[model samples]
Target: MSKYKLFLLRHGEGAWNKENRFCSWVDQKLSEDGVKEAQDCGRLLKEQGYKFDLVFTSILSRSIQTAWLVLEAMGQEWVPVVKSWRLNERHYGSLIGLNRAEMAQQHGEEKVKLWRRSYDITPPLIDESHPYFLEIYNDRRYTTCDVPIKDLPRAESLKEVLDRLLPYWNSTVVPEIRNGRTVLISAHGNSCRALLKYLEGISDEDIASVTLPTGIPVLLELDENLKPVKPRQLLGDQAKIQAAIKKVEDQGKAKPST
Candidate 1:
């Protein structure tokens, strides 16, 4: 049997994504451009003749829509997709749906940076008592009643994401790869990074330097031992990919809106 190939994709842009808001755990729909971008991603993958044995996505619509578009492009539209909350984006706590630049303007760049990048620091929890809570809670496919403003694993630094995500990788993903199934993972920035850390065994400090761009696919080739025989490749226009990643880093510095 041929060695299994793993494909990783981040979701297309969302409304908050366009507004430069922190989406984190908040479930938001894709913007018009985001939808087009997703379709373009599928077309690109289709042109490359990529196919998968199984599909996985975070419960969030951005990830889910991206996966669906990709499968449609691959002509595997009927392939079963498993949605898991464990694969969702890092919850941005009180920062959800808030514009980063405005927040920074009110709060200060240094504090915002700490909230955004610190390994274990969690900002304030989003209030379940807030009017938006029911809409948020009910929209989640995998989250439970246990998921409240405070109770939800509210704030998550990338390190915390790695902690929660790695166990799922070990218990679930590793087995799929070893069993010789071609797996396609549609996930968020940090969750994908967490997977990358496990695959590469990267240092905690170094992972901060890693950035994933939206709508790009990363392909991993592994051996019988499931170790990467080659490094990951970011598909599509190289210049566009780099620019996109830079945009993410820039957005992290934006102030929260008033």
Candidate 2:
């Protein structure tokens, strides 16, 4: 057997996703179309005869549902799953619940574009006293190195997501790969980007430009040494994937609500 195959996927669409709101670390479930998309993704994997040895997902429902659907499609619904906050989406900070169009109207399209697209820049952090913050912090199912609310109540740059997520990859994910288990990761866009930056050895500036589409599985084959054995293989209709990513990159470009 090869070293191990890593199947990466960004979660399917969410309700808030359709509304053009920032969903970073927010617990939104998959939309109806999102569920169907996940099923289609699973069917694609099955058609390719792909099999998974282990599965992982962020603590959020959307990611969890995507993983479940993929595994079901692969006919490995019984596979063990590991859920971790380290796999959570990039924290969107102050933009979490705000409407994108309204924000653009208030903040101007140019400024909103910078907030949404700039790789290293972070939006304003959310207040610790905010209701969402308290709910997330108190949720027993969510785990972090420490109280995220106390230390990080705001948005995170892509760089920050990498710093936090990489350690888990090195310690948890690498060992599995070394042991020759194929791993499937169901996570967020920026989180997948974080892992890709590490696997592909892409630079910070370049990583900012990398975008992964929703519900599209990326196949990364590694050698015996856990190095990439092949260029990534992206599944699904290419046109649809491209459009979804464009939407993400254009998060704040839409006209604001009057």
Candidate 3:
């Protein structure tokens, strides 16, 4: 096993996720397939002899549950976990409950694509009238954050997500990594993408094409400075990994079912 390592696992398919909805920060539970996915990810980690020193997860249930399932599979259920808003999924703002295919139909496909993948261009922000606004505002989790409730973001571009994420990486993750811990992060698609953008040094333009699939654990063996020493390893059968990658890439495409 590598000495300094990190595991990034996007949560399994959430309820909204199964519906192909833009489920960011909406706090949905895992779907049946998602639970199985998370359990299998854990079994893979155990079979591969991986042990995490600590875990970091978003406050959202899907991410949180994924982490729990992974640890239980490892029989390391007692490991510490830090749940932070910084690790939350990129807020989709007004697009929260909308299905991707429907959204692509309503707003041209290209515009929807940019909104989903563009580093700098964000979807429209959620107004105070949106239900997402009232939900988060009333949720006790936000109270843990030092910032005022009004200052929390309603939407975020990938660039903005990276900006919020890097501080946590710099302050919390990097230090623990440098200290030689095997870190596991259970987070959302966009948040992990932001972390990958920093670790891989991908450019603003290139990140648009990068897709991280749910329930797959990406293992990174980093050098002292945290650059990948080798290609990322997906801890599963090759065919399964390929299929998961395909599912993620298709999340942006126009589907006839919708």
Candidate 4:
């Protein structure tokens, strides 16, 4: 049991999350409630006696902050944190600031759903002239990485995300897992999906139905072959987790508030 702990956590809610906006790559801070949720997540992991060997998070601040909160609660803030853009929330392209409800209204529910949920369908690209482009595009940290900066991606499908993420997973994460160390990851929704889809071998059609609620820690114990010993388990109240998942699934609806 000591050799197989893998904890995957999505970041707590951001300001845009509360407002129902498409928040990819926007790098917003956690909301007040989000901070509390993250703290609670840390408390839960500490109660479960999770001591991590290493932590990984997206370059985005929200995910990084969640990792910090979780580690602090565990009294293991000293654990090393590795940051990577590969773990970023999927790029929302031209839809970055639009409310999901408005997007569904403009693009129609089905197209919006396909864009949001499909494995390979990329969203409409954001025009470089879109004022937001300069911030992430010109960011020095990403540009200097070994990953080609020109291909940093203005739009990304889940498949594209998985493609980019797998290299890091294979190159970095797999070795640590093979070394029998417990690992923790704090990441975004779509990035977590990429990991889940790969780990569980989920079908593309079925992957569309998957949703990750903010601030829950998902535990997976792998056998020697790296297959899950049992189904993934979510920590915390089951009813609340289900409700949160429902809320996430509802986020793409044309009438999101319904």
Candidate 5:
């Protein structure tokens, strides 16, 4: 029996990520450090003799840009790439452009934590008056989505993100993997977490504390039955990966007073 490989990557830091803001669907590009992070991930994968047969990414620029950088580094720029909105970060809704630390300060760390980390708790819905509402809803990328514009989510819980992502995973991604192709999925933190929850059978409460560091590749070897052969492996420096995860966990905390 042959084993198939799958790689999941959370896109590198975005401009909004550096500012500790909720980027969700605002299409922010990767920051300077983010660019380097993507390149470094590619170099690491290259050093390990990995080559992808297919790539998938969210429509968000950060995710797409990370895919591009990684492919460029791997010298596999010609690989077929698929883009889907279902893989987008969980929509932050009214919190889209707001700073996470400031929100934590105003709403109390506990409440903000619920919004950010709870499986079923969703943030407030985005209203028409929000600054980026029109820009995001009217974007061309969304025009091609399977659902009508009005049907797109204004806010979503982690469960909702997984619900939306599963259709794409089952219909498109699974087929490719079963066909014996090596796959790479470049997506956002919440989206990747959603998929991980499904793949690993993690409990909802346990999934909340799982933080994926940006730009590192998560390697999984799947048996012919599509089950993991062993524990998933994260490629790159383990110490740095832990520190990056700590950074992600701290983003929702209130900044200490001067």
Candidate 6:
């Protein structure tokens, strides 16, 4: 009856997050508040006597930065860390640099919501004509990806994110958990949600309602079969966590004009 521990965290607020933009895979860095949030998360986990044996993060700088801050705060900077493109944020495609609120205003809130939160409805694709296409495709990090640059996603739904992420989960992450290692995964919002959908066996419709607050650690105790023993615990101040959740939930809403 061994119970294994796992921690899932969305990287703290990024510059685009503060501006309510579709960050997708554009590689924005963490905001100042994001830096503090990551540090605080680390300190909080340290206070709870949590130490990670292995850490996984997307190849994106923001995700890597959050993981670094968290480990440093816990004085576990020496933990083994692995980076993978599979854990990167959902590819926002043509919507990459657009403002979320503005998109909502232009397309109607419901349409924007469907694009952002739906399980299978992908946003528009990013082709060679899109502004960021060359920059993204030419990035050195992607050159090392498991698949060719041409094969990477231009647009993806929540289901697509899960599709790309599952292989890594089964091949890399699950085995470590079975070995009794305390694992931490630092990832993007949609990426985290995608993984949760798989781990919790959430239906497509039910998954849309799940919004993760940035920087909060979701701790789960899993049975030998990798099923959660009970409800997952989100570590942090409840009020702040609620507010953060609201912020994420509101990102797709049209902002009232002055």
Of the pair 1 and 3, which is ahead by lDDT? 3
Compared to the true structure, candidate 3 yields what TM-score? 0.96
TM-score of each: 0.88, 0.90, 0.96, 0.95, 0.97, 0.98
Task: Encode model 3's per-residue lDDT on 99-193: one tens digit a residue.
Answer: 88877777778988899889998888988788677786789888888577788888999989998888888999899888878899999999999
Per-candidate local distance difference test: 0.79, 0.81, 0.88, 0.89, 0.93, 0.92
- Taking all chains together, the TM-score of candidate 6 against the true structure is 0.98
Lowest summed lDDT window (length 10), candidate 3: 249-258
Report the number of clashing residue pairs per model.
12, 4, 0, 0, 0, 0
Better candidate by lDDT, 1 or 5: 5
lDDT of 6 by residue, 173-212 (tens): 9999999899999999999999988888899999989999
In model 4, which regions exceed 4 Å deviation?
A: 1-3, 256-258
lDDT of 1 by residue, 1-258 (tens): 227688888888888888888887677888888888788888898899876888888878899998888788778887789877788898776687778888877887778777776666767876666545566666645345324533457567777787777777788888987887789999987789878887877786677678887888898887776777888899999999999988887775644443
lDDT of 6: 0.92
Instruction: Assess candidate 5 and give its lDDT.
Output: 0.93
Clashing pairs in 5: none
TM-score of predicted structure 1: 0.88
